[model samples]
Target: MKKIYYSLLLTLCVGVSGFSYALQDAKNIMESVKYRDQGVDRYSDVDLIQTMSDGFVRSRSLKMYEKEFGEERKGLLYFTEPSNTAGTGLLMYSYAEVDNKEDDQWLYLPALRKVKRIATNSKEGPFLGTDFSFADIERMRIADYVYTLKEEKENISIIEAKTENGLENPRTGYSQRIVHVDTDKNIIIKDEIFRQGRLIKVFEVVQLEKVNGFWTVVEAKMDNLVEGGSTRLIRKNTQYNQKLKDGLFNQRTLRKGLD
Candidate 1:
């Protein structure tokens, strides 16, 4: 009887330890994803001009309209908004700044010829008519998700995360996502999106390369399985901490620059 009791206690202790480790691993993976997903590495008060190559190609159908298959729209994409596009042009202006817990963004539209102020609450809108939701673009805060370490082996970590308020609407979107992370560089390799209890999309970071000792992505792709559409963005002419002028992000400055 004494031996049996000791065995049960040992098993229980091991289980508890395993659970705690899982939780910590999950949190770490989520933090890693959040860090790389946003342009956080770029210090505040610097402006960046990224030439974009964007393509709206669908294998099935996305919108309520009509589509058979094999349709795509290619254009230049540019933006400063965290969750939306402020403007798009051959020459675009973007100002990035981090204040407190949130990052602020501003875009100077060459067409409207005005500087647009993107509010924090408005980050949920669709970006530039893309199938990708605006919420999909923002940096995922560590506080928003509950993490669980699913597995770790071969120098790689897999974390399963369920975030509160993850689904912004009643569209039956994702409340959880599983992220595959590279332990060596703390970079996110892939993410599986879930809606309710089903998988709906897969987001992948591609063309991972280091520039000037900074880990950066040359291409990022998101595919919507339910909608049968995908968005691909390619980045070029990327530079960090260019020491942009303070007045560039302002409305008056936007107008003056164009003038």
Candidate 2:
């Protein structure tokens, strides 16, 4: 009985140590991906194409701008195509620290002629009929999730993450996510979103290239596994470290089309 008790205690100690190491390593890998310097500011024109499983395609033109202030990142996106959506805009501010504070988001609807604050609970809703959700566009805070290293490959590392208690977004459609990161570039190459242990969506970086000293995804796709639809975003005319005007990210500017 004494020998059996000692063996069990030793096994438990090893298991606890292994779990702690895995958690720390996962956190380090996630931080590298989050804090990898892109630039002080950026601007880009992009095409958003939504395709149905039936082969129908719809496209929209968009202009995006992003800037960093201290540990906070702000971004703005405006739609310029499909007369119906022209002048629609979205503004976001994400913080580096993942406290109880929620990111701020706003949407300008051309038809409504008003800029509306997007509720934090609505983060999981589809963005303008696209497969991508508002949460996907906003920067994810590392503290909001607990991560575990799933697999390590020659060039990619797979990490499994789930929302941490007290940091869970009630409206988030994903209960967990599996991410494949480029070990060299610290960029996410793919993500599989799951709800209740079932895969519901897949996001993939179709193409990437080094632009202005940063590895940029030139083309990406988000597919809704259960909905039978997908959205592809193709970047064009991308400029990094540009001197973006501060006012461009304000609700006032969002309501008014770019001059």
Candidate 3:
């Protein structure tokens, strides 16, 4: 009887220890994804296609430049297509999860001849009528959530992250998210965002490839489950370690247009 009792206790301890390890491992995995290497800088031409539920489609084209400075990242998108949105651009500054700093975003509209800053409270809205939100482009902060390993496949790990900050409305606007990570590459292959216990948005990778030795998402899509629309981003001519000038990432470039 004593031997059986000791064995049961030992099993219980192992189970608890395993669960703790899983939680810690999930956190480490997410951190790695957030800080993946993509060289010092990257440049790409992107096509944004939006498909409405009624079957109508709209498209735009932009030149994207992103660079890393220390632990922070900065990006600039200069719209060059459709003539209407030509010369329009967005400048973003992103920080690491440990800092928990709110990202800065500025949108330049040539028609208005003005540069508008995205308020911290207004990061939940869509990005220029596309399915991807401004916060989505800025990326989510990992410090505000707790991650749990839900499942592990051959090369994928499903992690469920719950917000513990307890804000009624967080910057990202989603309360919880299920991230499907490619364990081998430490890349987020898909993201399922939830709000109020319902799935409202999904981001999926349509194409994944190694460009110039960097794991890149050649194409991706964001689907709005509630509104019945989706947006796809296709990257063309992606080049890494471009030695892009710092001047290209500033508000002046956004105003004057990318050279």
Best by TM-score: 3
- lDDT by residue (76-158, candidate 2, tens digit) is 99999989989999999887584557889999998898888889789889899899999899887786678999899898989
Better of 2 and 3 by lDDT: 3
Model 3 per-residue lDDT tens digits across residues 1-259: 9999999999999999999999999999998898888899999999999999898999999999999988888999989999988888999998765676778999999989999999987888999889999888885577868899999999999999988864424677888889999988889989998888889999999999999999999899999999998999999999999898877888888888755
Worst lDDT 10-window in candidate 2: 165-174
- What C-alpha lDDT values do all the predictions have? 0.53, 0.89, 0.89
- Top model by lDDT, which number? 3
Query: Per-prediction RMSD in angstroms?
Result: 10.7, 2.2, 1.7
Off by over 4 Å in 2: 1-12, 165-168
Error of 2 at 65 (Å): 0.2
Q: Residues 1-259, candidate 1: write the lDDT tens digits.
A: 9999999999999999989988986786666654443222232211222222343332211111111111111111243344233333211222122322443334456567765655656544545555455456544556546788888888678888786655633322457788888877787778888877678778788777776576766677777677566666555545544443433333454445422
Compute each candidate's TM-score over C-alphas.
Answer: 0.65, 0.92, 0.94
